[model samples]
Target: MPSSGETTTLASGHVAVPLEEEDEKRIFRNFPTFTDGASRLNPGRWLLLKGFKDVADRIYNFKLRESDVVIVTFPKSGTTWSQEVVWSMLHDPDLKGAPRSPLMDRPPYLEMEVDQWPTEVKFFVPPLFQAMCPGGDASRGTVVQMLEVEKEPRVIKTHLPLSLLPRDTLDKAKVVYVARNPKDLVTSFYEFSRTIKRLQFQGSLAEFADHFMRDELRYCPYWEHLREAWQKRNHPNLHFIFFEDLKKDSVREYRKLAGFLGSKLSEEQLARVMEHTSFSSMKGRDEALGKSDQMNSEGSFFRSGQTGSWKQKLSHDLESKIDAWTKENVADFGSDFKYFIS
Candidate 1:
């Protein structure tokens, strides 16, 4: 499926999976080491998780077409919500048929490494594979392997920051970046990392907040990630949306997205998209696609999808620290997008 010969079909009837050890080593060598010069998987910092290296390479080498729509976000920053909205906007509900599986199954998280997921999470991977593969046999191929074969105007998702992203892909395709306030982003990210074993971030909230402040967390130095995108907000091909803004009025944001994607929807069509992408609606429909089996104790992916949930979780001191840090890094950085820190 990989036109560039990046994928391999195995003799055992599998494809692009069980990556060769050599490839893993080669891919890691390309990623920048930690700021503290520690192991790549150092606590709080991002690591090249299992299957990440291969997916990263595939994303870099994969051809980019102008019609492609890429959903970029820092982890847990309303990515799933945006994906559902975009997917709904792109397809005709009656003609194309309602999504048989979850939005993740249809749009596909480009960097989602199913094989690399923790064992408990792997149980849910089979359902995702069934949705993607023809015969419902997950053994057919890897995540990227399936994406490599997808049709044009593909809706892809990624957590990569601008610097690490493939330039051509951003330049040619429609890029939608969704970011949330650092407080909520960190809270959600912390909860998500704690749930997903692969992230290896085991610690108290205070410790996690400290790590975040030091820019030691995955795709962090949150201000910088937001800053980079903010600078490019005016770019013709890019559309930037704030999570709080969407939370306040998803209909307006959805319409903005439709306009950006060049999808002209009738009033009735827009209403349908809004209803389908609602938090309660998503929670009710895609439980399997929301949180994996490993996170059964935690709850759904639509966990309290609100703007100020941080007030309940974050201590006053941590909130102050976040506010001060945001003021220094984001507000004082000459960012016109300072309101995003809300």
Candidate 2:
């Protein structure tokens, strides 16, 4: 529930999600020639996008407290995987596979809807995510909604770029931002856009790459998005991690995350979380596949969970274009962070 002065609940049952006038305009693309000036996202982007204009206001518009734990990412940048990691680390280490509760329940995607998801994937994915959660959605509310309401520390997820979300998401709470290589992100998003038809039909990978290089995808201006966060890397509460690094050293990333969260993990429990979340383990599995009930499997969320999958598909001209764009846009991002675009 939003505190006073922040939200307005409609008698019609429509949640008046809060937003500044500028943010409100982003929704126009959903209706007309909407473009955030990045790439146009596929319909899959709309899955959680529905309530952001209002429902999201039900959550994000409220003032944030220090205890809130949020995971922010540009779409297709291992947002889902980071959700799983935070969920596991924040809860009881003893609870293992087939959790006591669903994953979404514990630390739900502030935006993902489980009831609408397919039966198989949503049900199982929710559990792994939920086990870490103390009670789940029934008691609290949506992840962002709960974060707005709670004084205790909590874990939540978001795919909105920094500019679009309420500033409180940054100024007041702890932010865990994850990014993946653009080539990988491009390939993954192409697959993601197709999952939701509104993004555009799956054109040749070359066509998609052109859109990507041009920064026309949803939540795009990819380099700018990453750079915004990168500039804030020095924040004590901010943890910036890469998907490729997590792929190579899951435990290392886990430990780094735990340190930022101020949660301690035993070596064995750390190993278990890493092993369970491995890309190989998650691939084709019901949870990662997005085939389950939680989300529409139509466009597929887990697009080629491999790093270099781009090399096999991208051409030299496009690669150069991508390279040039990254240099112009991302040159200022910290050196510690490297993109897998090459």
Candidate 3:
């Protein structure tokens, strides 16, 4: 068995063995599990397998470069928000003016499953990226489009754990990891879990806590993934930003990001990015309301976009369990992570 902190060495030596567990394989076997059935609440019409499935092994794999930028974060942890921020930092001027690119194309999501829309909902989102940029380089491929890719100065997004990515991705690429308070994560996850295809029903909040505590969900054991990037925070090419930090001082946060990306923006440009990238403003835009990222979603992928929202939904009893579970599961157990907010 691999040690907790061990970096997996693949047969090729350079490649790494991704941290795959039984639950992930199980979820792979029975994907698109349910849609508003007894097992699900936030349901989708169709679910397609990207990784751990048939084609992605060859299709989704990509070789990143030193100039590439990757935004890594746990699911629903301000992924779209961070993507928007990073995109605007580099391309704000271009995006702000006419012939602009939507958030997706300028800085795309790298490895997660692409959400395709149903025919009914598809009409709402008009290829926000393809239309906005329409740059000659844009290729409309599946998750695999990035496979074997060697894009310089590229910016992409991903939700996969650090162990799964190519070893040099960070070494070669600028990596930005976004983390949120576990309470908010778990709070968002409860609703997001309702959308996942497989899992045993634990009950309302308490029921799910058991699975979460046990790390039963695919892309789970969130703390380990968090630490994987957290440990690398000091790396030359890495930056880890907290959701709370952005929530507290977004204007300043954008400036910090602009600086990281080697772009300097005036207060006016920063204000515009902050305005459009604001959750409420983006929510009003057609893209998010329609799952503009292309995952055939019926509802807003950016639904109720905010921080500390977990408080409204998580039970006190469940919260206690989650706090304990997070402490136990975090890689260094009281050393590496700051899971609580206030």
What's the C-alpha lDDT at position 229 in model 2? 80
| Candidate 2 runs further than 4 Å off | 1-60, 96-106, 111-152, 196-202, 284-289, 293-299, 340-342
TM-score of each: 0.76, 0.69, 0.70
Best by lDDT: 1
- Model 3 clashing-pair count: 11
lDDT of each: 0.65, 0.58, 0.57
Query: Candidate 3 at 45: error in angstroms?
Result: 29
lDDT of 2 by residue, 279-315 (tens): 6665545444455442355655555676778888678
Please estimate how well model 1 matches the true structure, expressed as its whole-model Cα lDDT.
Answer: 0.65
- The C-alpha RMSD in Å for every predicted model, in order, reads 8.7, 8.5, 8.1
lDDT of 1 by residue, 1-342 (tens): 111224433222223332234433333232232111111222223333434433454456566678889888987789988887887788762224754445656677665653235434532354555545656444433555566566665788877666545557668899999988788888887777566545435576777777677665545556767777788888988999999889887778888988999989888888888888889988888777667764646645667788878889999898888888776775544535635355
Which scores higher on lDDT, 2 or 3?
A: 2
Q: Write down the worst ten-residue block by lDDT for model 3.
A: 37-46
lDDT of 2: 0.58
Whose TM-score is greatest here? 1
